[model samples]
Target: MTTSLGATATAASSASAEPGPSTPAPADELGVRAARIRSAELEEQIRTDPRRFRVSTGDRPTGRLHLGHYFGTLHNRVRLQDLGTELFVVIADYQVLTDRDVADDLPGHVEELVLDHLAAGVDPARSTIFTHSAIPALNQLLLPFLSLVSVSELGRNPTVKDEIAHSRQAAVSGLMFTYPAHQAADILFCKANLVPVGQDQLPHLELTRVIARRLNHRYGSGGVPVLPEPEALLSAAPLLLGTDGTKMSKSRGNAIALAASADETARLIRGAKTDSERHISYEPATRPEVSGLVLLTALCLGRDPRQVADDIGGAGAAALKAAATEAVNEYLAPLRARRAMYARDRGHVRQVLREGNERASAIAETTLNEVRAAMKTLY
Candidate 1:
């Protein structure tokens, strides 16, 4: 459960404080401010129709999760669970089949990934958790869903293009190509009404909505639609950069794990990239390095990244680095302890996932029956 400093640094950096605007507000302020705006929208949604809000989001267990995953989605997932909405967190282990290279270790990796989730505060007791491999009925829903979506539509998805460019695979597998359909199945199987997604993922969610609409139009008899049109609850999380001052990613070696030890965390932060400029400012365009430190400070302290940047204004980059390191360590100390406790009880983590899978499967079974009955596929 202990995240490596490498894994947690991105999250810490995301929490960094930023400098305020001289005339208006700093560029770094834009992300947090935008998030506030979006948060208000979410609050209104919850207030207006609490019963209509059910969130389903998942991660592909290809590797260990980084701080980006924590702040970007995991934290939000925890908050949504507390809001009394039905939450479904999936470990998309089967999605790993898209890359044949990692196919062999998928099962073990899924377990480790689950452990990471527990360490990061995804409570299985309150929220349902399941892996794609464990939910056969859900996977079965993929074929009919696929028929509803066109191949050209899948080919046109921006994410598919990005993945093709980034992936090592020379040719995209059928699973990789049809990932959106699988995603549709994931959402519809549980009839999830809300899906928390990043801006980049909006298209995928849109496709899910399209598929749901198509299925309902084609199959609806006298009763209601089998699937609900899932709405996208876009996240306003700031883009966190890696130690190299680039996008934080596991593949890039710039990411810090969520469960890293204190010593490792300190070392990673110490080695983080910063501008040569003596003074700290949150100018993302000009001073990305120093700005990164400022942003990290803001997120950790729950203050404006701009404010943090201004507080250390005129202070040398050395001072900013020191402040950033101290702020990150302070924030992560308690998390590290909690992660350690969870890590020690590995069996407990498995049990949580197993129990979650049972809960999720029960729901999946009921939904599948309804789906099959609607399609007249019931024997």
Candidate 2:
């Protein structure tokens, strides 16, 4: 089933982390509007020459992607690809070990991740999709980049701090501490100039810029250039809190996976936390639970959360949940259908990955050769 994506998904961030929008706006007037405005402006810029814009976005492949991933990053990816931007989607299988102990399920995990990407309308023909471990040049690039960053600098990355707290890991892995460097390798290898991601990842993207500048300054001291400093293309995904009124993560058991069945989606939304208040309103500060449901409903239906709350005026929590469930099921219907088809065809998926690996290796090899030459190690 070849999914020809015409328009990208329009899931603006509810920006909800804990049953409320990330911004302090009234639940009715949250991140959705601002995100949409920004996104539209970015889309307008897509008509620029494609060669001038390259994008790199990837996932850890810890598990299959979810609705969060769709609205958060996947939607914009298609738009970028359509605009003729050189794109590379990396399956960061190695990064999963930062918190995970075993690779017992890594192979299946990587396959599932790629399946979700393709099913979501990531055209392998347009975008280079490859696994991180398969790109040996990226691994080689990491060591030299590490010398450019220090322990103190790495420790100051806010995103890393947040991830550590989220992971609840008492002992941090050395690899985890240096994750930004590995990520920089991915972006710099492709010389990607734009990366679409959620706001939470801004710091990591900033780190990539720092790495590129440092490398160009030191290695390209003679006004030569090796790496391109990348910029973040933040998405407009309105925050969609998990059913539990917290961050939507698989570990937290609150995330709604992209491939979740209609029935499963209904079940999860039905069980989502909501206040006992018999009437729904957009008061996020006091009624975070209800506000999150409203925000989620707005995202699925492409309307303002405040409007959703008004539509459900005087409706009880149960009614609110039912409405949200219906909206989500409707939004996910086509995606799930395509996903089912991809899941059944493992042979085809493997072939796609194999091709992606080769293409990505060639690209990375070209970059590595340049880096070696710059460092006077071209022997």
Candidate 3:
């Protein structure tokens, strides 16, 4: 089943680690509105003093990233880094096992993830990129965080439910069932004050917000919260659809991997689903498939989708595909070159990860110490 634009299973930061909002409900309206208002406030604060915000965002190493990731959150990450916000980009390597039993070629996937970050203009010096497994203290927060939420709350999470249904797993693993706590650990471990996410992931963020408040109320020495309540940094961009006109997901085999060759990109776009109409127009409600293609093309060319459609008016699906293919390939060429260059030097990639792991481990250790002190667990 295809996911709606506002309710995809993936999120901006932990798209790989936790299940996101995949279903819509009336109850979420108030939370969504509140998040939007907070996001606007955060944006204003960021422009004035970007250094004040610490953002925790990342992806799972399930597969190489695609256009959806690039346009959705990757650019935002780089922008935040340039703006002076401290960023913790976790690879969430262990989160892969939440649903699947094994992570095939796990190390390789992690390396590729770093390469994508580097190629996408994410300065490693400005941000910390690390894997989940490398930081034991980070995972230690999970047990405390899990204690804050009830079993029913975990089961009721829309993101987890959608992920379980999508995974088609007959039995849910403990890790998958408690995915929100794991995500809370991810955010609060670094004490991230902001998390970039989509509308659907607001529920997951709400859980994190609750965890922060509960921990503070229960364990704080005075009025200060041990963890700051993180606000959602909602993206204004619409979610990109897959070539099949469904949600853009690597698991569905409908996405174009960033590592794909120019020829491969062209071939994929050529096979993209478009309507039977000969004239192209940007009407997402009426012509989703065709409009998706136009949007992709416009994202690459930095132009408006409607204008792109207007330029290609009267041209059939073939013309639309050609335009998208050319635009995407051209836009991604330099990034691909950087990726290839980095891929060749495996040693350098390893060094980047090693440094990142060390930095993250140190921070996790410090955070864990604080938690232990707050809980009076220090022996």
Q: Return the lDDT, model 1, position 22.
A: 57
User: What TM-score do all the candidates reach, one by one?
Assistant: 0.87, 0.87, 0.92
On residues 1-379, what C-alpha lDDT tens digit does candidate 2 reach at each position?
A: 0011111122222233434445466542444445446655666677756667889988887787887677667876876787788889999888877655436788899998888888888999988899999999978999889999998888888866866777656887788888888889989888888888766677687789898899899889668678888766766555556888876787778889998888898898888888777878876667877887887777777776677888889868888989988988998888889888988989999999999999999989999999988889998
Error of 2 at 188 (Å): 0.5
lDDT (10s digit) by residue, model 1, range 171-240: 7788888888898888888899888876567778889999989988888877688789887776656677
Q: After superposition, how far is residue 355 of candidate 3 from its true place, in Å?
A: 0.9
Candidate 3 structure quality by residue, lDDT tens digits, 1-379: 1122222212212222323488554566657767778887988899899999999999889878999998888878888888899999999988787545338688878888999999998887889999999999999999999999999999888888987887756777888888889999989898999999988888898899999899999999769778899989987556688999998988888898888999999989999999888999987767888978988887788776778899999978999999999999999999999999999999999989889899989988999899889989999
Using lDDT, give the best candidate's number. 3
Best of the candidates, TM-score: 3
Superposed on all Cα atoms, the candidates' RMSDs to the truth, in angstroms, are 6.1, 5.6, 6.1
> What lDDT would each prediction earn against the true structure?
0.77, 0.79, 0.85
lDDT of 3: 0.85
